[model samples]
Each structure stands twice: as C-alpha cells, then as structure tokens.
Target: MPLAALLERVSLTFRRQSVPAHSGVVTFDLGPATGYPLKLHLSTWQSDEPFRWESEADSVTIASGAFLEPPGIAWELLLATEGEALLQGMPVSVRKVIASAPFLGVELAQVCGQLQAARDLASTSPLLLILLVDRASATGMPQADFAEWLTQKQAVLCAAVDLPASKATAKLLSRCTLRPMIRRELLELKRCLNTPQGTALLRHHAPLCLEHFIFLSHYEGTYWPGLLPVVDGILENQRSQPGQSVWLHRQLADIEGMLGDDRQALRRVMSLEAFQRLHDRLLDHFNDQINQVGRAKLASELRVQYGGYPPAPIPGHEDILPITSWEALLQEGQRMGHCVGSYHKSVAAGRVAIYHLRAPEAVTIAISPQADGWVLREAKARFNEMPTGDAMRRIGQWMDQLTDT
Candidate 1:
C-alpha cells in the first residue's frame, strides 16, 4: 500500500490541550480504528524545566520518561512501523530542534521556522508534507514559510550532513543523509561516525571501502563494532597501494582467527605492524607442533594445573569438554585444520575459553567475554568447516543454558 494510505489507515491524531493552570501537555493518539493503537502523552510546565513524555498502548505503559526528558518511544515506534518515510524525510535541523526543545519553549520560534522550511520543501518532496504536518500538529506550531527558512535549513544540511555522496544521498539532497537507514543500522552508523577514521572514510568518498566496512559491520558472527577503524585502515591502505599482499577478501575471517577469544585485544594493538607480528608468531607456533605423544603429555600436565579454570561442563552434553591447555588447542587445530592452537596464550591468560564437542561431530567452539557476558566467537568442524545443523542446534541450546545460569 502507498505510505500515505497506510498512514491514513493508521489514523494518527495529535492534540495540544490545556491541562490545569500553569501547565500544558501534547498528546498523540493512534486508535484501534486504525489497527495501530498508541498513546503518547507529554507534559510541560515552565520554560526552564524539562518536559516529560510517555507512550501507552493496550492499557499498559509501553514506555515513559523521567522528569524533564523526552522519551524516544514515539520516534522509535514510528521508525519501526509505517512512519519511517515521514521521519526519514525530516531535515536534520528540524530533528535536532524537536529533540532539544521537546516542550516547545525557548526554541519555539526556531522550531516553527524549521517546520515552515519543511513546509516549503514539501512541494518538491511530498514526504516532507507528512513530516511537516506531523511535527507542526504535534507541537501546535504554525507552518507558513518565512523568507530565511529554506536558506537556514539548507545551511544546516550542508554543514552537518557530511556523509559520502551515494545513490541513497544523491536524491535526498535536503533530507538526512542517513534517511535510508533503519534504527539498528543508524545506531551502527552513529558508532562509526563518532570515530575520526570512520568520519574520514565517509567524508573522503571511498564507496568501495565503505561498502566493505558496511558488510563487516553488519556481520553478527564477528565482533566487528570496535574493530571498524581497523577494517577501514586496512581497506584504505589496500586502495592506496593495490600491489601490497593484503588479504582483502578473507580479512574478516583472518582477523577473527587472530582475535581468538579476546576480541577486545584489538584496542591495545597500537599499529598494523604490531598486529602483523602477533599474526606471524601465531603462525610460527602452529607450525612447530609435530609430535602427537609429546602434545598429549603436555596437555595432561597443563590440564592438571588449569583444569578447574574451565567453565562447568555443559549440562546435557556429556561428550563436550572444555579445552584448558596449549596441547589440547594444538590437537584441536591440527584436527580441524584451523589456527585455534595459537589461542593457548589467550586461554592461559583467561582472555578466551574454548570448548570441544566430541559427539555427533568433532566441532570446536570458542567463547569470549563481551560487554557483560560470554559470546560465542566461532564454532567450526574439521578443516575449518561449518558445523552441521544438529550440531549447531545443540551448541545453541548449550549457549542458552549458559545465559540462564
């Protein structure tokens, strides 16, 4: 269905009604008549005080704000549903004003002016009309255009919207450069935009590198958030010097291997040369293990010393065992044709923990500490192959147990 028709069916209504003396509130209602029932209530008193906002649906408060705060529940809900185009079409200037002046106080004039600017732009971009009406009605602001509205809003767009020119931005000259992005993608983009390297890449117009960066950023298997700059730097170098033997295509998997179970270790790595040195050392160590009997004896001794450090056995998986020693790592790596054996130092330092599943399939699992809890870094069968469906299901059940505990 057309976005306009969808919105009409949603039956969005906004009211700026007087409450008691010395106070006012803006209420937005999406009723069951439209199939999307939501109630947003905002209360404001004096100009110096912050406004409060809350969202309710089905007779329950889905979200609420503390004193003087404007909860993002309204915007988030809009973006999650059919109102995305309206929000995405809004100029950044208008968005900033709405966020800063939720109560329509000191910035009321500025807010109205931006809304008028939105009105002026709506002729050329019809979606802006929907956005303009939404904001203007919600805040009870006038929509007639002022002479300076268009020029001022244009200046804000040019200054703040420095994202690289792409097909997405090419058409949205007056709207947010990130207009095509959804909420989660916007969050990821914000993370990169805060960093100098990421900003540089975006502003410098490196589409190829940006494409690779986006791909790696969205990959859930690898902890790629903090390592975005590393990927950007490598891609930049590759672009500048194509003759270099950089593993451009396989960089993600290779970096994951180098990371082992301690993905955060990338932060301490000061330079590409330092990363190369660690990679070389791991390669050398993996190549040196040749004697199986010697490996077994060393595994026994190390297990005797560090066995208690491993996490308790996975409850129902009697065939699974935690790998607690360098010899065990080597054996797993040799059998799996992977570089996990080099993770002994990380395991010994308690930075990473490895688990081996011995039944249904010989799979090696690596879990590492993330922000608050453990995360599965990677799970692979022999020869660096992906585990079978049943094996993965079992691994997932074990991970769920870990979370429960």
Candidate 2:
C-alpha cells in the first residue's frame, strides 16, 4: 500500500533552460522534508526525439510501474525542473542517480583540496567503507605508500569486476571509489529499469552486483541461463569439493562428536565425503556443463565472468587473521566494549555463544576468550537469518580474540 500510494503521481514537463535535460523536472507530492542540500551525482538515459519531446507535454503518465529511490520523495523534484524543451514522445523515468553521497562530490573535493582543510579532516563512521575502483586505479599505488595520503581511513576500495567494463563509457564504473546506498535505495534504482533505457541506467547504479553475479576473464564461452540451477550447482559443488563445505563438515562433525550427536553427524560426514568423490569423477563434466552454460547465461550481463577463480586474488579470509590464542582475543574484545560500548554489546555474559548469520557467504563465530585459551559457544551457519544481535555478537567474540592474542 505504501508503495502504491507513493507512485500514485508521476509527471514530467519540459521548458527552455540553461541546463540540458534537467530543464524537464518532475514534481510529486511525496510530502515535505527537512531540506538538505545534497549535491548528488547523477547520469541520464537519452531518449529518441519524439518521446523526449512528448515528455515536456503539459500532462503524461507517471505510471506506478516505474521505480524510484528515496521511494517517496518531494526530493526527487530537485533532480528535475520541467522545461519547454521537448525531444520525443515517450515516457521517461527520471531516476536519481546514486553515488557515494553527503561527503561525495564537492564536499570531498573541498576537504582534500585545501592543506588547512586536510589537517582538520577526519571521518565519523566506523569501519571506513571504501569506493569501488578499477584494478589499474588501485594498483597504481606504491607498495610502501599508505592510503591515508588519498582519503579518510573509513574509505575503502569497493571490489572490482575482473573484466573491463566498457569499450569507452566504462570509466564511471571502473573509477567509482565510493557511494552509500541502502537496500531501499537499491530498490528505487531497480524500479527505474522499466523504461527502455531504465535497465541500462540501473546497472550503472549498482556495479557491485557485477562482482558477485558476473563472470570474468574470458568471453565466447557458453553460459548457464538460470539462477536457481546455478545455485544448485554451487551447492552440489560445495557438497562434492574437498575444500570449503567439505572442511566445514569435518569440523562440524568433530563438534557433534563432542556433543554426542554421533549418528546424524556421522551421516553428514559420509554424505559430503561421497559427494566429494562423485564431484571429482564428474569434475570435467560439471565444469563443461556449468561453465559453458553459466558463462553464456551471464555473458551479455557481465563483461567477463570469473573462470576458475581467475588470476587476481581478492582479499578475503582465505586464511583467518592470525591470533595466538582465544584468551587474548577475549581480553581485546572487553577493551573494545569499554572503548566503544555504545556501538557494541558483550554477549560474553556466560558459557553460551550464539552465531547468527546475516547474509550469503558470511558466517559468525561466537567464543569467549580466557587468559590463555578460549571457549566456542555457537558458530552460526553461513547466511542464515540475521537476528538483530547476530552480527554484533559475532564481531564482539572476534574482537575478544583479537585483544587476547
């Protein structure tokens, strides 16, 4: 109901103006707001002449089917102001282009541009997030040079697509280093895709998806066409592979044995072991079927699909961060609780530890550190449901380990 109510009205008109398409701003009654002069970064979809011209007509449809971000915003009006310059006769979805915001655009320039401004500069957010950039942009850094010479600490490099994005127009994606968009904002971005150009523009909004859902390195291979089946293949491979799921299963079994759930636990162990053998036998077949079909399915969508983990190694916990012992970790966590108590909470109240997963491919481990050793309470499975405390509880335990070691 809120969504329908929000899209109830959408119209655009054109007028002569010094600015280009911006002369055609659409205004909606999404209610009033505390106006903040957010200097937003935006891009547009160019339409053929008649549709563009009709867009400036006094009245047209702002269909509910179209998508917008900041969902209901009188703020969308700032992106456009109706003008008399009309091009063609078709509907245009005036989507707010999303980018690293607030501190993006001129705000960041001013701070980095001046020496005095740079001296007083600091960021307020925790876990300085980073901008996604091309491999070349990041590799340009010298081995010994610290990144602080570039931007704030909270700023991080968003992962890059292993493939070259554009024949030429790809730099925006390759060079983008920072943007702050929430789930709702992403929804808004997707909604705009219905217009002929909306889908193309929408992809520009979320290059991050290019990293996960895409392929890299080579083209021309056949592609897998379906999402669910690909998921099934990934699961099957995990079941069969000696690495990843296999390792986790072995670990889970030992814990189960400690807890006396031997039968079911043993069953899991055997199943994975069997799958691993089958996978090895069919390894050639699976790779052929999956890669050919998968690559084709994703080909047009992604510039280069990842083939056999490709050449570039991304920084993930290939190996866990080294710490001497769990006890040292706990002490460090307690110190964190003291320093940033408001942002963190200690679930270390007792012997019980619970790890709840927040998203796909991530796991939370719960533990309590002692003077020299530590205790494992509950380790949540990968990407289950994220209870509110799930992430923080897991991180706190991690912090405890860091401190203790």
Best by lDDT: 1
How far out, in Å, is residue 346 in model 2? 28
Candidate 1, position 369, lDDT: 80
Shift of residue 3 alpha carbon in model 1, Å: 18
Candidate 1 per-residue C-alpha lDDT over 1-405 given as tens digits, one digit per residue, 9 for 90 to 100: 332344455444443323443344445565543455666655432222223455667777777653222343344343334332224334554454344323332133233333455434543432222333334445544333322323544324322334333433322323322233232443344344334454443443433332333443444334333344455566456654431222332334455565567766555554455555555555445546435356777666656766633543333358678875566677777777667775655676666788898878989887878877777767778755668888988888888987899
How many steric overlaps does candidate 1 have?
Answer: 2
Q: TM-score, each model? A: 0.46, 0.21
Off by over 4 Å in 2: 1-394, 397-405
TM-score of 2: 0.21
